[model samples]
Target chain A: MTSYIHGEIETPVGPLPRIATKWTHLDRWGALKTRWSVGRMKYRVRPGIYAVGNPDRDSRVFVTGNFKLSFDHLRRNLEGLNCWILVIDTKGINVWCAAGKGSFGTKEVVRRIRIHHLAQLVDQRKLILPQLSAPGVSAHEVRKMTGFTVVYGPVLARDIRAFLDAGLKASDEMRQVNFPLFERLKLIPVDIFYGKQYMLIVPLVFLALSGLNPQGYSFDLALNSGWKPVVNLFSGYLAGCALTPALLPWIPFRRFSIKGVVTGWFVAVPLLLAGTLGISLMEKVSWFLMMGGLSSFMAMNFTGSTTFTSLSGVQKEMKTALPAQIAMASLGLAGWIITRFIFI
Target chain B: MNRFVYLTDVVTLELDVTKCTGCRMCLVVCPHAVFGIENKRAVILNKDLCMECGACAKNCPEGAINVKSGVGCAAGIINGLLRGTEPTCDCGEGSSSCC
Candidate 1:
């Protein structure tokens, strides 16, 4: 909550517990640090400016969203660099998310610069911002409003030092956004956190029903209805958040939703085939319907992550897709219920 | 232009040609290259490509441009609708639950 300037710290040296710079195979330490970091940043965000190191008037100033996870990751990766952290009031949203929402935008950035009187603190009229933020903020407008030149930095803050040292030039790789395993893994918790309640509630209800009903009927009921729902939920969430982001470019299809649909199909086909091989025709049909619905619904969830689609386009999509999804889910549920009661 | 079913109506996207100063700012900033300058004036050669990122609107000095811009995602929109907020690119809606 406390905002800080550059000179507050007594030591010029940075904090301990450095983020591992070496790219290694995912291990216990990486997992531990990631989980701990995500937990610690659980929306502990207050919108204000922060100083990364003991920066003087001459040091560089970098702009970012107030999301603690984004802020922490950016600062932790700075290591020994002296810089001013100008956090815009993005309501604790990360840069990419905020940009998509227009919070990490031209108006907010300009407004923050004025509100904080950033001109007085820094001698240079330059601000290093995340390149992804370009979609939201107009560099020309920022300069016109705040008299500061907006320099789009690397996509990842971890590469800030390298970028800064290299005469404020970003390499091609730095400019490209990569959703490798670590990046994809980090996003999973956020997705889960948002959907966990819905996820847990549905399953628990089924579990309760399974316990209450007669042995064969209840067991059959739970297995028939509950298992697929739970599986679909997991499959959908993973498809949208994990698989969509991780295998972004390689997933094929230009639209993000299509990419997610492809991933969902990959998951669904295997399961459907497996179920068909082992189960009755009715069960197989139910599985097919459930899988199709789950994949489509999850694919729909991915419209937000892609570079394509407009707000109007998305609205039009929701108007069409959401109802269809609901109908599919409803039909799937009805099919499952009928099968559970009559067949089993 | 051959009408595509998915494309928003041409009338829905009104580009005030009079307000345009022919700076080509929109032409350069647009990721999709939606706008193309013919002579001095900018024209929407492919509005379908518009993701509505607001790069054109934000940089437009004369208040000449507007488009429905926001996080074009189903989850983001659903979250917005549930909150009774009109979706157009304001991420933090005074709650941690929101994006």
Candidate 2:
């Protein structure tokens, strides 16, 4: 209803807001900001009917969620096609995710069609839904309730043209959800920020604890040695939130937890070999445990962003990995603390 | 070729081929290409490839496909363990990004 909406168009549903297929600088900027978790929750478009181009009753109606990003993708893909865009209220969630949550679902689709008098506005009895929404919507049921057939579109908005050109048929690639490098990279920023609030506080606690030793506390040692743990911690975080996800496919483990540990050591071992962790064997081993444990946990949590991990598979992985990660971190932290208290 | 595959022999996705009715709804909705039509009936072609998002089960009018589907996120699982509820990314605050 802001910059995107240009004019008003009248239909059987009454005067409806019109949006363009153009992308402004602000629109692209909003996408970038949201990628980095800025103003993420509030990034929404008012859910209702939106007209893209001078659409008539015969123009195809494309449905999407209220999330502005979802709307942007759908509209941007609609380039030359004139269509009526129906934005469903999914509480600012993207279509695929909302569909998974059952918000962008059969009930909502039917509800929106009824409330907006979509049947009267469109000449055709078809609603083009994103294929991902099939998880929440029963196409047969929608047809039964709304008297309109649901034709599922491609998984990616970019493939809309191909889908439409193929007589509303989707290719195997169009239906497949991809997790390429760029997509994985784009998702890393938000995950890195997921534990960001704890970033400073956690390191500061270690810094404070660094001053302890057999001869009591020493600020000099804290300044000199504390930075090493800080580095290890940050490197572990980077490996978990960035490296593990970015190199997900290449890593040699089916379990994300183990993959995290692998990537964690891949980065941490270099620092350990450089003798930056500590001089003592206890300190060196403890850093590996802390770093690997932290990274493994963060990487495991990244199962949400992946495209192909199943619920049962993840649950199975978490069963043993979660306990192991906890024990490793706890034992490592306790060992590191004890090393400070005694000269061994 | 299987670079994208997850844990093997772990997915619960099952196909009752008798009741399939060969609608191909499962074939169309599965993001992992887990289903294929064999002899005009749906077959579980790649069972391990199933992320079990439940798209096939929900869209199947014949009720032939069944997979205990839910969010696969570890944070969602931990949250579920804490709350004693089903795995969900919809918990209040902080988890907004999870879903």
Candidate 3:
């Protein structure tokens, strides 16, 4: 029970948790932390009916995923309005992503409706679902199963009031999913931390491996040269996870891998110019390849977060790029290790 | 049109105008504005814009649109490869797959 839930309300179905329209500072803070991947999985409201303001049987029944962020958005947008919210269990995942996984889906929606006795709870046979849920929830199927006519709401939760005020009609722009710089920025933290374990393990291993050379492995040499690979790897992470997304649209090439490699080189080249890369040309090239490939791989994963990429396109790119990336990274690693052994 | 377009000519989305009943449900559900009604029938305005979400195909009453819809996520693809299943993001509790 979060602070958002004020009290309980008696309904025909049962006593349901009541949530407030305004978000407290703590609740707002939770959203920020969730964006940073803290308590992300556990951030969910109880899946069922929640009353916003005082709602009667005639009130609008809005549907949303149980993920707190999704629920918060819907409830917050419903400020000063009377409504009944039907929260579907999405395993603590947001609507769009959960819908993609089929958890915030037709079956789950129907199951919640039946278990909650929604038909008895409301007079109108309507369930206003977020438009993004359409991929998982077939309106026709919901109509057939639960006799509830599904109305797709605007893509953004903030537009919910306007959509309702406009008599459930979304303007053309309301349906569009825009990857604005701000929205892309929000996703940056999560993507950066996506491989936190790898970030740590790789660097520590590199620090130890930096001791290697033709004569013998030396701790003093490791101490002197260890920070070089660390800088390269971290730069790769930032370029792919942060810079690539920030400059996604302006970057050349449609494939995200090429885009990442471009950004990766952009970041790595600065290090080369500063003389941090290495003394040997082979070592410098190896560092560039490793950093660029690391960035390209990270940015390729970003296709998941993007709004416009098709499954076919991603699959095609992965089929070609994945092997190439593996080879590039492997060869770079081999080359770096070789530089430690033979003069280049 | 979205300024953030991806690879072109790669989407599997196919719209059969012959089966379109002019209900325009695809227009309502399509997040990318992929389908448009021309001469009282649905036509794909930009096939490349389609994310293959399958919303249009799923919501179409006439079964006029067809595409293999799934997550375009690389980690999901890798998970599918490892598990020998379709691309899924259900990597529960501390899984690397983003929500």
TM per candidate: 0.70, 0.97, 0.97
Q: Chain B TM-score, candidate 3? A: 0.90
Q: Which stretches of candidate 3 lie over 4 Å from their true place?
A: B93-97
Clash pairs detected, candidate 2: none
Winner on lDDT (1 vs 2):
2
Q: Which ten residues in a row have the lowest lDDT in candidate 1 chain B?
A: B2-11
lDDT of candidate 1 at residue A57, scale 0 to 100: 74
* Best-to-worst DockQ order: 3, 2, 1
Compute the interface RMSD for candidate 1.
5.5
lDDT of 1 by residue, A1-344 (tens): 22212234322333211122222343334435444334333454455556654576787888888765576667766767766777787766668777766778899999988877778777889998887687788888899888998877887787887898799877756754433456455555554455555777876764544333323445555555556546654765666666666666576655454565577667766666555312557655554455556666666664554555577777766686677667766786566555544553
Q: List the residue pairs that clash in candidate 1.
A: A101-B89, A304-B73
How high is the lDDT of residue B97 in model 2? 64
Q: Name model 1 segments beyond 4 Å from true.
A: A1-54, A76-82, A100-102, A105-111, A134-189, A207-266, A272-278, B1-50, B62-65, B82-84, B88-99
- lDDT tens readout by residue for model 2, A64-180: 998889899999999877889988988888787788788889999999999989988988998899998888899999999989999999999989999899999999988898899
Question: What does candidate 2 score on TM?
Answer: 0.97
What is the per-residue lDDT of model 3 for residues A267-325, given as tens digits with 9 covering 90 to 100?
A: 98889998777889999999888888899999999998888888889999999889878
